[model samples]
Target: MDMQDIENKYNKLIIRIPVFLGLALALGIGIGFMISIPRKNTVSEQSSKITEVLSLIQNNYVDSLGLDSTANFAIQKMLQNLDPHSSYFPSDDAPLAKSQLETDFEGVGIEYEWVKDTLFVLYPAKNGPADKAGVLAGDKVIAINNENLAANTTQNTLFKKLRGKKGTSVELTILRGKNIQKISVIRDKIRSYSVYAYAINSEIGFIKVSKFAEKTDLEFTEALKKLVEKDKVKKIIIDLRDNGGGFMDRATKIADEFLEAGNMIVYTKGKHKRYDQEYLATKGGIFEKGDVVLLIDEGSASASEILAGALQDNDRAILIGRRSYGKGLVQVPFELSDGAEMRLTVSKYYSPSGRCIQRDYKNGKPYDKNLVERYKNGELLHEDSIHYDSKQVFKTKKGKKVYGGGGISPDYFIPLDTTDLSTSILNLMRENKLREHASLFAKNNKKILIEMGLDKFDKGWQIEINTFRNIVGNISMNTTQSDYLKLYYKSYLAKVLWGNEAQIQIRNTQDKAVLKALEVLK
Candidate 1:
C-alpha cells in the first residue's frame, strides 16, 4: 500500500474505535482502551510473547486456575495500577454498577435506617412492594422468614433478604409501636429520584440534585418552573453537598439553565486530540438572571464541580460550603465479550475557570486516604490549611482566582458542624426507634396532619414530651442541650405524613449549610 493507503487505514481504524470517554460522564467511572500496535513487527512479537506466557502458565503451572477468571483478574490489576479511577466490572456486576448511577433499581423499594444493629423502615417507595404490603416507615424488621436478623445482620444481609429477582417474595416481621406483625412483599424495580426541589420559603427556592442522573435535568426544569410560578422566587439554592456525580450531560444541561447562551460550561483534555471537547450554555434559561447559590462539600465531585465551577466561574452564583471532593479524571467504558466492562481513564475535565479539579495522585494514595489526610492536616477545618501549587492557578470570567490540582474552593467556606454527631440526644435519636415514632405519629394523626399541610404543620406542629415518651416506650438513653430535637421530630412526622420529599424540605429549614445559603441570599 502507498502512503495515502496507510493514512486511510489509520483513519479508518481510529473511526472504528470510538473514543469511550464522555467528559465527566463518569469522572472516577469512565474508561477507555489504549492498545497501540506499533508497526506490525513489534506488535506481532509482543502479542506472541504474551500469548506464550499465558499458555505456559495454563499448561505447566502447578496450581490450577480458570483461564477466563485469571485473565479477568490480570486485566483488573493492570487497570488499577494505571490509575485510581479505572475499574473492571464482571458480567454479573456490570449491570448493577450501571444502575446505581441511574434512577431506578430492582428491590423492595424502601428507604431504611439501621439502629442498634436492627433494620427500621424509613419511607417505603410509592406503590412499591413494601408499600403494597402495608410496610410502614418505622417498622422494625426483626426477622426474615423467622430467621432473626436483629442479632447478626448487616446492610448487605438486609439487602440480600429484601431484594431478589423481580416478582419474587420475602417474609418479614416488623415491630410497629407496641404491635409486632408479619408481612410478605414481592420485590420489584424502584425509582430513585435524583432531583429534590421545594420552596425553602416564599422567597428562596431550594433544589437539591442528589446526583446528575439521566432525568435530573428534566426534573430540575419542572422544579424551576414551579419555583418561578410560586410568587416569583427571588433566590434559588442548588444543593450538591454529597452528590458524587453521574452523567455529565445532565449536569451541563442543568448548568445551561443558569447561564447565558454562548458561555462556556466546561471542557476536557486528554493525551489524544480526539478526547478534546467543550460544552457551552444555550439560550433561554429559566433562572439565568435570578440570584443563585450552589451548596457543596467534600462529597461534591465530577459533575457537581462541573455545575458549581461553571456557575462560579461565570459569576452567576456563589458557592457556599466546604471544599469539594476533587475528581477531575474522565473515563470511558470498554465492554468485553464476556459481558464484563473496563472503565479506563481517558482525560481530565476542566472547570470553566480552566482549572482541572483533580487532586494529586502521584503518591498512589487512595481518595479515601487523601480525605483522611486532609482532616489530619486541618484542611477541611481551615481555608488557610489548603495547600495548592501556585503555578496551577487560573482566572474565572470575572477575574476571580481559582486553583487546580485540588478541588473547587468555595467562595464562602463554612466549616462542617460536627456538634450533632457528638450530641447525646442526636446519637440517641439515631440509635433508638425515632423512625418508628415518626411513623406511628403520622399514622395516628394522618387525617389532621394531612389537612394541616407542610406550612401549617411546621408552624403549629407540636411533639409533646408525653407523646415522645410513649413512642420510645419511655426508653431513656442520653440527653442533649442542642435544641434541634424539635425540628428533627417535626421532620420525621413530615416524612411519614407526606413523603421523603416533604421531610427533606422540613429538615432543610434547620440545616446549617442551608441556613448559611439563606443568609447569603439575604
Candidate 2:
C-alpha cells in the first residue's frame, strides 16, 4: 500500500490500455480492407476483359469494317444493352443534333414536305438561303449538282448532298412557276426561330413555340415583344402538341417567365447529388396577368412536362387537350472517347408540386406500354375511361389535388375523335393510291399547279368528281365497280392538288379535341 507502488501500477495500466486499443483498431482496418480488396480486383479484371474483347473484335472480324464505325457501333450496342433510353450518336450525327438542339444550322432554310420521293418547299425561312436565292414556296427541287434528286434518291442522301459548311454553294435545278430553271444557293448559317408565328390579331397576341431548343427562351421573348408592339394581347395559347422535348434549361427558363419570384419551377434529386435548384421569374414580363392556355397531347414530353407542370401548379395557365407523354427522367449526354455520345438517364425530374410525371418503368422495362395499355383500357376514346392515381397525391399551390406516377392530366379532358377516318380512305392511303394519283395529277397540270399559292390553292381547290372518276375508271376499267372507285379517287385528288395541310384540315374539321380546345379558348 505504499505511494510509489500505486503510482507504478497506474502507469503500467495506462500503457497496457493504449496498446490494446491500438491493436483492436488495426484489426478492424485489416478486416475492412480485406473485404474491399476483392471487389476492386474484380472490377479491374472485368475492365481488362472488356478491353481484351474489344481488341479481339478489332483485330479479328468476319468482314472488313471501318474502325471508327465499328467503335461507334460497339458503343451504341453497349448502351442499347443497358437501357432503351441510353443512346449513342456518331460524330456525323452529333453535329446535326447539336445544331438542331441549339437552333442553328448551315443550309438553305426551307421547311419541305416530302411526298413520293419528291421534295416540295413548304415555306422558305425569312432571310434564309432559299429566300435569298428566290426559291419560292411550292417550288419543286428536280436536281442537285447534275444528279436527278427527284428520281429515286432517298431524303437522307439528298440532305447529305445539300447540307454543308457555311458559305458553301449548292447548285439546284428547280422547277419554279412553270419554268425549269437552275439556281445556285450559297448555304449560310441559318438560325431557327423556335417561336414561328408571332403576331397580334384583334388585340390577342399569338406566339407558337415549336420546340424547347437552346434558343427557345430568347426567341420566345422576342415573340412576346413583337406581339406587344403590334397590340396589347389579353390572352395567349402555348401549343405543346407533338413536341417531344429538348434542353432542360430551356424548360426552366420558359417556366420562370410565368412564375412569381422565388417560386420553385422544378427540382431534381439523384443518388450522387441532391439538386434543389429553384427557378424564379424576373421582375419584367409582358403578360404576367394575362390569361394563358397550354395545349398538350401524348407526344408532349420532358421539357414540355416541365413547362405544363410549372404553369399548372402555379395557376398560371389552363391546360388543354390530352394527357402529356410522361417522360420525367433527365438524360445526360456523355461523349465517349471515340467521338460518339451516349444519352444516359442520370436523374428523375419532378414538378414544382413534387409530382414525378414519369410512369412506372420498373424491372428495367420500357414504360412506352402505358399509352397503349391506356388505349386498350378505353382511355383515348372517352374521358370517363381515363384512370388517375388515387393513392399518390400532391397538392398544388391553390390546394388542388394532383396525382403522380403518370402524366399531366389536363384540367379539361378532350376525347380523341375518329369520325372521318374510314376503311376506304385508310386503304387508299396505305396502297399509295393518294400519293400516286397526286403525282400523276401534278405531272399533267405541273404548269398550272406551280402558279398557285398555298392560300389560294387551299381555298379554291376542289375535286372534279367526274373527271377523277373517269381517270380512276380508265385505270381499273377491266375490274367491276372500277367506275365507282373514280369518285373516291376524285375526292382525294382535291387534297393532293392543294397540300397535306389542306387534307388534314378537311379531315380534322370534325376533330373533337381540336374543337374542344377552340371552344374552351373562345
Best by TM-score: 1
- Model 2, span 51-153: residue lDDT tens: 8977888789888778777767777788667544556678666544444455677888877755555677655666789878877555777778878765566
TM-score for all predictions? 0.83, 0.72
Which regions in candidate 2 have their CA more than 4 angstroms from the true location?
1-44, 114-116, 132-136, 139-143, 147-156, 173-182, 197-203, 274-276, 363-377, 417-518
Q: Which ten residues in a row have the lowest lDDT in candidate 1?
A: 12-21
After aligning candidate 1 to the native by TM-score, how far in Å is the CA of 110 from where it should be?
1.5
The true-versus-predicted C-alpha distance at residue 281 of model 2, in Å, is: 3.3
Q: Best candidate, lDDT-wise?
A: 1
How does candidate 2 score on lDDT? 0.62
Provide the clashing-pair count of each candidate structure. 7, 1
Q: Give the TM-score of candidate 1.
A: 0.83
